[model samples]
Target chain A: MSLKRVGNQTVVFAKPPVILSSYSIVGPKEGQGPLGKTFDKVWKDALNGEKSWEVAESKMLQEAMNGAINQASVPKEQIDFMLAGDLLNQIISSNFAARQMALPFIGLYGACSTMALGIAVGSMLIDGGFAQKVLVGVSSHHDTAERQYRLPTEQGAQRAMSAQWTVTGAGSVLLGSDGAGPRVTSATIGRVIDFAVKDVNNMGAAMAPAVADTILNHFHDRQLRPVDYNLIASGDLGAVGLALACELLKQSGMNMGTNFTDCGVMIYDESQDTHSGASGCGCSSVVLAGDILQRIKAGKLKRVMLVGSGALHSPTSALQGESIPGIGHAVVIEG
Target chain B: MADQTQKKPLLSVTAEKYQTLIKQYTPKPTIIKNVVRAFIVGGIICSIGQIFINLFSSFGLARVEASTAATATMIFLGALLTGLGVYDEIGKFGGAGSIVPVTGFANSIVAPAMEFKREGYVMGVGAKLFTVAGPVLVYGITTSIVVGFVYFLLH
Candidate 1:
């Protein structure tokens, strides 16, 4: 109960909640990536047996949550809360999956940053003694996201170099008050920063400023240097946003060094033809659940900072010539 | 145009400023490559149509009937390719070349319908079947009717 608030936008947990278990389900493309073997399940079919891509996303989340909960050895009713989100309009994938799961759901919409946002909130709930166990989930389907946010897959529109392909996958993490695993140690909530960037295709460019802002704030609030963490990961800046964020950070006299990387750039191989790289809510979610957590358990990484960034522009707003606003939330996970 | 310019100097200034800023980041289209791809694809599609027309005419059909049969055959091929998920690939490679043809019209109708087929037969497939191609059909039919009416009146 002692002061958890730190600096302007950070919260340091007095008692870090343990991540009991994590599960990730990815599509064929992601399954073909470097960390493909680490995922609990990879659907070879993009549709994943569902009739539509949206429904396929819902099913992916449902299966991910079920798998994570089962892996954690916790029954569904025992889990106190379920926090989840997706990129679809009204976040229908999460809502529909929650309906099927029948858990007490707190639906969220952080665009691509939903994973980190959910984990941060879940950590707070458990640390605050309001919940003994919490489930955090996030998902994004490339087709569904394209249909809602951009052009349909049917359109076959040529993507610009800065455009990122949304990752088709889902990931779930189960956090508990008492568990023997990596712990959620702190969180930094990001502010919405818009520098009047109105291009919908160049989301990495739109979100880079916000990532830099949150990372700087998180570092200052936590009084930690970049060398303190084994690795620092961004949500979905890809090639373009990562460079911009690093430049911005360098301007602030902070250097992340060789430890810095982005989930978007890591999830897809360059030959995959993802213009910038893999993006979406599922990018960081599955990466954290599958790659980061596994590495931590294997004694390779002791500390990691995951900064999830999201563009908050809607299609309607973009069409109306409104600038794209972006957010980034940071979570510190320690082994 | 002169009166508007005289009345709205501030509007012009703002428009110019916005235009300059947008131009900096706007992606430059590869015009030559696109034009060449479009021309080649369009020519190939038209040549196929011509072959179909010649074939039908050699079977003793009239010229108009042969042309109509060729158009129907092209549309049928387009719809079949769309169903088999090949038209999208062609469209991806050919860009406007594929889209400017009657086959592309068939593709536009079938693509969304196939995508929405999972929602249900009536509300999903049937309704969305025309979502993409609806405007073209409406305007094309309407303009043809207008032209027909005008020709009749003149006669």
Candidate 2:
């Protein structure tokens, strides 16, 4: 009932309700290309041959949720809640995924930031003693995202350098009352900040305001500078957005260059030619699920500010001549 | 018997609707299962393609030409299958499997106009322009600006 209920405890009575345990996923950590080609491959692997982006995405979500549950050795029936979402309107991936898992659910839509948002809340539920076991998951498929959000790659259409490689993969974590893993220590929910750039398709610019807002919140709430974080990362800001974040951070009086980083800019290898870098829900998850969590588990990373960002634009909104809606969430995980 | 068959509507009509009418009915037509099939099929297709690429090398086809041929084959296969409606069936089943590749992108653009032709040119052909490509152009530019700016700052 009071703010004291959610204190900033590093060792907080904080049972994640369940251990983040282990995560499993499929992605293109090996090679990269144009966003569309990469996404096609992601869907190709994720959906197999499913032509429909929505269909493959739904299935990929199911696979990701299954990975969390199966890896945790938790049965579907035992789980109390499942929180998930994607970039699609109505979050078709999360919605359809919920259908397959047949678990109680909450559909989230924080863009690439969906994973961190779900993780932050799920961990809080465990920390707050609300639920004994919670499963938080998020995913995206390149093809599904492409059809829903952008071009079908075959047209050989050119993408701006700021465009991010929408990763085609799935990620999920099982959170519960176990304290053996990286504890969810503190979470700062970012309020929406608009830069007033209304070009709906141009999400990097649209989301900059939200990214700046959350990074500032993370610093303000923690009362610390960027040096405090071993790494301060943003979701799918890509190349342009990531650079913009640095400048924005400076304007906010915090220099994160010594530590600040971004998932979107990091996911791709140099070959990708990804102008901005990586975007979409799968970007953060793949990085987290693939290596970041492992490093944390190994005591390699002490503190990390993981933020996910998304452009909140609808197919019709872009058509209606409205600016993109941008939202971001920051989750601070400390060892 | 004929009238009864006509009245029944195959019950499968529900399958094509993308939504369910019955409240208590369970969610079926799992996309996950279909995705798995698509992966298997698409992988096989890719592997076969690789084999062709290798064969072309052995047979003296240059890399560029071989790659182009491979892409051409995929496009031809894509267009032909799309024309036959088989791609749509795959689209319904695997969703992304058939759609995620260069082929899926192909379908996103072409499928609409084919459906639209019945309505005449402006609505059909013109309408198809934005159906799939719109997201690409818009996100494409915005993402490019972000990427370019990032490169500018980071570099």
Best-fitting candidate, scored by lDDT: 1
Q: Write the per-residue lDDT of candidate 2 for residues A80-181, one digit (tens) a residue.
A: 889898877788888888988888898887877898889877777776777777887787766567656665433323344345667777777787776467
Q: Candidate 1 at residue A334, lDDT? A: 95
Question: Model 1, residue A60: displacement in angstroms?
Answer: 1.3
Give the CAPRI rating of model 2: incorrect
DockQ of each: 0.11, 0.02
Worst 10 residues of 2 chain B by lDDT: B1-10
Leading candidate by DockQ: 1
Residue A144's lDDT within candidate 1 is 92
Which 10 residues in a row give candidate 1 chain A its minimum summed lDDT? A150-159
Candidate 1's residue-wise lDDT over B72-131, tens digit each?
999999989888878888887788899989999888888887777777999988877786
